[model samples]
Target: MESSSPPADTNRASTAEGLRFAFGTLTVLPVRVARWDRAAARTGMVCAPLVGLVVGLVAAAVGAVLLWCGASPLLAAVAAVAVPAVLTRGLHLDGLADVADGLGSGRPAEEALRVMKQSDIGPFGVITLVFTLLGQVAAVAALYGQGWAWGAVGAVASAVVARGALTLASREGVPAARPEGLGAAVAETVPFGAALGVAGCCVAVPAAGSAAVAGSAGQVVGAAAGAVLGLCAAEVLLRRCVRRFGGVTGDVFGAVAEVAACGTLVVLAVL
Candidate 1:
């Protein structure tokens, strides 16, 4: 008779696989995800912020180089905003647009989800994408106008928080809207406390470093406040999507990330 516990290697957790899964699914990065099981999803969600960190750094580097090359803050900001889109192949933006159309359709859950899966974007999607992109560019420009360092900080901080929001969305008890797809694969893969721990680190680490560089306690407070507000905005959207759709979907995750990034950028620009 076979033993009850199965093989030791069956569910073995690998950080490398986790990173690959995170980068592979989240970005246009070439990393191959070797596993598609719950174990992989669990590790991937927890490591999502690492993908954000790299994306943010790339975005910041582009903006900073542009600024150094005598580009206007607006132009640099546009580059900064565009880099992540290019890197992720605009996956999150499309999700945001789709989500907007779905929610804006005012139909029942099934109909709305069907609308979301369609190839063509509706008027609601177009309008939402326009304003959201504009908000991001404008906010990045504002931060850049202050200085390159501040602008870099804003780009990096917002990206990390945005992806961290995904981890929260994937935590235990968050059901998937459908029986298949990414939402279902990664649904409830993370422990709630673990998600919170990751989120706290995402907020605290960047805020602390940014404040130190700025040489002000106020900057620390501002950074924390901005991150907190961003996460709060994402949380609101997540709940709304869950309630409206009956659970979370991959599109919902994308929408949540974009909203979190936008919120963080706007708040950082203001404060």
Candidate 2:
């Protein structure tokens, strides 16, 4: 029998076409970067809050189920942590470690990026990740134990607000450290409005609910405090990244998201 012949270029073209068709649904670009075009950016900005909404729903559902199942608050908290890790495939955590390593090394920006790109984790990265996760776990467990729904809300809100930070940072003339990547795409798309919308939805919705829970104005005040803290943290990180790297990278964006999330959680827990 004759040997089978390989597929022709037409087959390759068809495969490429299929991939292109699937790209729209497979990517999370719209969340991190709004569109540079006015209309597209607006649409993306409007949809930006939806990411938080989804994360919030997921956290709430899981928390409810765990509570109902009589799991301890600690276990429930662990579940909350697991949700995002699973959803994003630990991308933010990896970014956190890499960014910590880069920042701690006192190396030049290029060298920092090179170190982050390496697979090995440095001492700074390891210590930061450990403490960060411990803090998150403790905060979640404590809030849940106190029967406060604000923890779940904060988790979701952080997702949106963090993206908002990333979007806003992109607009402030931060070049993409790499020639092409998610950072560049985000820089091209993220507009101011999307960032604003995200901040509004995250802070406002939670504030309203918190006010009802407290039966006083303190809830709103607390929520505002949390929002401000998160925003400030993001801005500080953005400025530092810009000064150090001359532009933001995907890793830095990830770092911002992680920091904002942690900062929001800390503020909520304290207040």
TM-scores of all candidate predictions against the true structure: 0.95, 0.80
Which pairs of residues clash in candidate 1, taking residues 3 or more apart in a chain or in different chains? none
Clashes of each: 0, 4
Error in Å for residue 179 of model 1 = 1.0
- Candidate 1, 63: how far from true, in Å? 0.2
Residue 18 displacement in candidate 2 (angstroms) = 20
Off by over 4 Å in 1: 1-10
List RMSD in Å for every model shown: 4.7, 9.9
TM-score winner: 1
Clashes counted in candidate 2 amount to 4
In angstroms, the error of model 1 at 116 is 0.4
